[model samples]
Target: MKFTRTANANWKGTGMEGTGTISTQSTTLNNAQLSFKTRFAEGVGTNPEELIAAAHSGCFTMQLSFLLTEAGFIPEDLNTKAKVTLEDGTITLIQLELEGKVPGISEEQFQELAQKAKAICPISKLLNTEITLSTTLTA
Candidate 1:
């Protein structure tokens, strides 16, 4: 399946001093504010890194869920957090932390499936940086 999604950003003034608003096609983020303060400093808005983290986490978790179903294991809960690290104006690493509770699945199987999801998820594939995964299979 091939599809496309888009978000729009509008900025005014210089990069350090300029402010912008981002609006997604789905309207989940309609005219959300973003600026230098939001990206590099503390501010009440969203930033690019945060958005990427959200996307990565969501994508990885969904891919894992699909793999689990395919493997005949039903997941009770799966929580994932993606951390995108930016240093020196370059994205350095992305860390994915996952906690999962699945019935009738060995820890080894869970880890293997999560590793596959990390490698195959669309966002994971799109990122051109180091990616790490830590998984916790819970009872």
Candidate 2:
């Protein structure tokens, strides 16, 4: 099983003052604006770090849902946030914070499963940065 995703970017002018747009094949983003201001300072548009955070959070949440179901627990709700840090032109770390409610699961069991998912998720395995998971389980 193989899947491929595509996104395209177009830029005009120099890095400091240039503007660009990013579009993905899925059309989730179509000509979305981006610029140096957007990346390094306050501006209107999306940046690569934001996109990575979105992808990591979505992937980790889905993986947790699958793990909970496999463990015979019905997931009520799951929310995850992935924060990526960039320093000195390098991505330093990604922190995943999750809060979940599930029926018929102990906190220890939920934490175990959440850690398993964090270790096995595709994006987690793909990234070269340090990844950390913090989970809060609610009855």
- TM-scores of the models, in the order given: 0.98, 0.96
Clash totals, every prediction: 0, 0
Residue-by-residue lDDT tens digits, candidate 1, 19-71: 99999999999999999999998999999999999999999999999999999
Give the Å error, residue 89, model 1: 1.0
- The global Cα lDDT (0 to 1) of model 1 is 0.97
Best-fitting candidate, measured by TM-score? 1
lDDT of 2 by residue, 13-78 (tens): 999999999999999999999999989998889999999999999999999899888889989999
Segments of candidate 1 deviating more than 4 angstroms: none
Any residue pairs clashing in model 1, and if so which?
none
Q: Measure candidate 2: CA RMSD.
A: 1.0
- How well does candidate 1 match the true structure, expressed as C-alpha RMSD? 0.6
lDDT of each candidate versus the true structure: 0.97, 0.93
